[model samples]
Target: MTELIAATGSPSWDMSRTREMVRARWGDKALEALRPVLRAVTTRLIHARIHFQDYQRLVSEHLRQPLEAGTPWWELMWVDEEKGIGASNYFFIAAEGYVYAGVQAQHAIADNLAHVLYYSLGWNVDQRIPLGKVSLGTVCAQLARETTNSPELAPIQQALDALSTAPAYQALADVTNHIKHHGGLPVRVGWGTSEQTPFEVLLSAFSRKQQTQPPREIAAFLEETYDAMSRAVVTTGLALNEWLESSVAPAPPDNSLHQDSTPGGQELHPTDQPARV
Candidate 1:
């Protein structure tokens, strides 16, 4: 069974985890290596927080629904009338910002982490096509192949191996792909015939301006998926950090990463080091 309860005492935007991700990806002396990417990731996550706060404010202030802190909104129908129209109206109006922000926050988290993962493995992530264009599994497979039969890359290989099988990582990869590539996320909630979890809002539900409940199992699945993703990110980060620190060999150099490599291009000059955090 999944751990239904959330892990304790972590903020939604875990700065400590953020630091860990960067530090672990590069060793202590190489903070310079992670500077630019960290700044970019931090900026994105901070924007996510702003969106989340705005969303929560709207939901708390205008909606009549009796919501418990941290409760997934899909459970409201089970607690009261089957998909109350009044509640749905309040939800649609008040929770719009929350839904949008929620999705954006998830995207930012996935995006930043994906970059870190790419960089940690000694890839010239700066030269590759945007990672969002590629799938997580493909990234892992490519890394595994690059690291094959090399003892120095063993730790990196181990981390990659675990990520290939991790449930949380897989869930995150699936959801991120769906949100970024598909029309939109599909959520199910139980009511007369439907239900929803706090994080899920069915695109179809809103499109029809009505409710459709699936089953508690589906809601639970969504909840578990998000929960797993949260845990998986930290796990992947720690493994990455370990890999970066443990590898005895120097990271592979790529000419493409040189600030001056792209002649006349907009890349930062070689003298302009990425600033320290």
Candidate 2:
């Protein structure tokens, strides 16, 4: 039952249950809370509204064929299981700078599809990325490499290149590690509330473009920002560990004695005592 969805432009059903689990984990309140975070991340990643629009256009073109053909893009990511407790499906739409997970069984497939469609078209866009086969990291790297020719991105590329020998890239190698290893660089102050959300971290890493000095200034900025983010991740990890320990520990049993007893031999506490004379 696997198929590629038109809007998402990727094979689905592989992670349907996983998607549901993520949605469940990020309940309605959490999801609503995440919007501001996502917006912040988007703002940091994109320098201008025009660039965002261009990115959206690129992704839109990729999805147009499937939509026009009336292909079932929604079904590609749907979970066929009758019961599941975790996220089993997930997909990314580069046109929109956010990922969607089916938290509830009743999430309107058509509506979700339409939302992604409109997002690709940039009808009401904020931020986006250019369509491509490579992962977002590779895309970002490519952008950095290409920008070596541009005045704006030249410093950014230089700074990033200097750090190629540093351990930062090792942590940033994968999505989870990047998020977990680098948490709160000023560039990525607010992206998502997830324990290891990396949107902001990546944005901060890319912000080396804003440095005023040449190679030295850019290098310093990259190192400082990476250090700051790595520290934040360490702090967050410690806090999370403490919270998990408290949550998983069992509560102590109640041991208070009753002060009053009923005529029927039922034990009653003093708070349930009759009025005093």
Candidate 3:
């Protein structure tokens, strides 16, 4: 049986079948328009993984040293870029850029996906399906509503439902929004023990604080974001392709639209499945 993969859970896609169905059902231009959007975002997500890995390594080096009052903690950063204050900050900013780009790419995916979906559903190219300012859950509900009563559309609906309810998808959206509208991810500054002034240690002594320095950190969140975006490409494409297949496989009567697109559904938490890149 063909499994409906969760959004953010990568799955193997039959590219030839997917292409044929989209061309036949939604027209050649439909796939043409959508590919570039997915390509742009997916490409960025792929490279972001590398940058995150390097950044994580850089952060890890600093974490190995003990944060003592007289030790050469972050003060050695100039000679050593990995554990140095300047280098860590630079990597953090670089990592932030990748995370922020993923967020932008998601918006691009949603807007472009809506355009392709609306046009395929018989709406004019000029008449776009509004997807701006709406959550991923909202978009899924609207699409599922558009496909109600047509069992042929059930696959697409199930995919949408899965997207609506998946925690990773939700977290993906939340992270994207937070980064875009809320400045960006908080990569807090960690103090170097060697750089710590005597007065700073004195204050720590009075408070009886063992937590004198910031926690050891990595850009794990950004790496996760990178993975999430990469997975979304496959999962979302699967949904679109399955819907297209259903549309073309069915007779005219079965494919006719009887209901207007509206948003409504109880989001279901999707079970785990095999993951792919």
Candidate 4:
């Protein structure tokens, strides 16, 4: 019977493959736990893509100007001598209440939706973290502690705490970390692989430090930082997008209607027009 079972040709599965299978089989529950975080992540990703496109456009424009003028290409135009030519980068810091509120609200709504899905699917809370409650209180306590010392951080910290307690936040955090570590463009930018921006440098530094931290602090600090980073990146991205859209050059006027002037002050007009001596 053992030999027969072994002969059935079932391929061995690795942990990642197993997890994927489980996720698929219990997608509804997983999604419920993930929707809020995923939605937040999706919005940020969209913002990032827009920012990257804008940055590319800016570089293209800078490169095109000298070429269009029939002038020798200037390396200085393509490279900011001091800062380097690239899109400005930003991140959401919990110090900014308005941006934090928006992110928290989106996360909260996603959490509620996930809870509804979980309840509808009849999944047992014991099988997973009761993200709807357990984690919420923990985050609230942490926020209270942190805010007691810094009143300015109160509102944003409170909002972040609310989102942190949600299972969806965890799911989104996992996804974002994975993407950053892997090959996603946002992560590539975040890691300082694109153009060097202050935010990119900070994120890259954080990523390197995160690998060495203990698990508990890693979780806590990451949760604290995620919203802040998101806001900064999105703001920077939007600004760059606006700049690119507004910077487009107007089409040239009809050159045929004008006359060219020589160095000796002689004018040469088109054959159809009377020449000025």
lDDT of each: 0.44, 0.28, 0.45, 0.33
| Residue 123 accuracy (lDDT) in model 3 | 38
lDDT of 2 by residue, 9-117 (tens): 3221222221122223433343333233223222221222233344335334433343446544343224466632122221123322321111010112112222222
Clashes in model 3: which pairs? 77-84
Order of candidate numbers by TM-score, starting with the best: 3, 1, 4, 2
Candidate 1 residue 79 Cα shift, in angstroms, is 21
- Model 3 score (lDDT): 0.45
Off by over 4 Å in 1: 1-33, 39-90, 93-96, 125-135, 151-226, 248-277
Candidate 3 stretches with Cα past 4 Å from truth are 1-11, 57-92, 102-138, 189-219, 223-233, 249-277
User: By lDDT, who's the top model here?
Assistant: 3
lDDT of 4 by residue, 1-277 (tens): 0110111332311212212222344444553453343233334333333433443344344433434555434342344636544322221221122222323433343334233223222233343435545333443454467568756445434444545544546544544443346532131222122232211211222332345311222222333434434342223223222332333234322324322221211111111110110
Tell me the tens digit of each residue's lDDT in model 1 across 1-277. Answer: 1111233443233333333434445454334444455344444434444555565455454322444453444545334555565665565544444544444554555545555566555454354535456445556566667566655555545554565576644543444445466555443322232334333333332211133322223223334444444444545555555555555344443323333221111211111111110
Q: If both were scored by lDDT, which would come out higher, candidate 1 or candidate 2?
A: 1
RMSD of each: 12.2, 26.3, 11.3, 26.4
Count: clashes, candidate 4: 10
Query: Candidate 4: how large is its RMSD?
Result: 26.4
Worst 10 residues of 1 by lDDT: 268-277
**lDDT per residue, candidate 3, 1-277, as tens digits?**
2222345643544444544555556665765654443343333443444444454454444433433334444463344545456755674566456445644554455444444444444334444345353334555566666667656656555655655455555555555555566466554444533533211110001111222222213343443444444455455556666766656855332213322121211121122321222
Prediction 1 global C-alpha lDDT = 0.44
lDDT of 2: 0.28
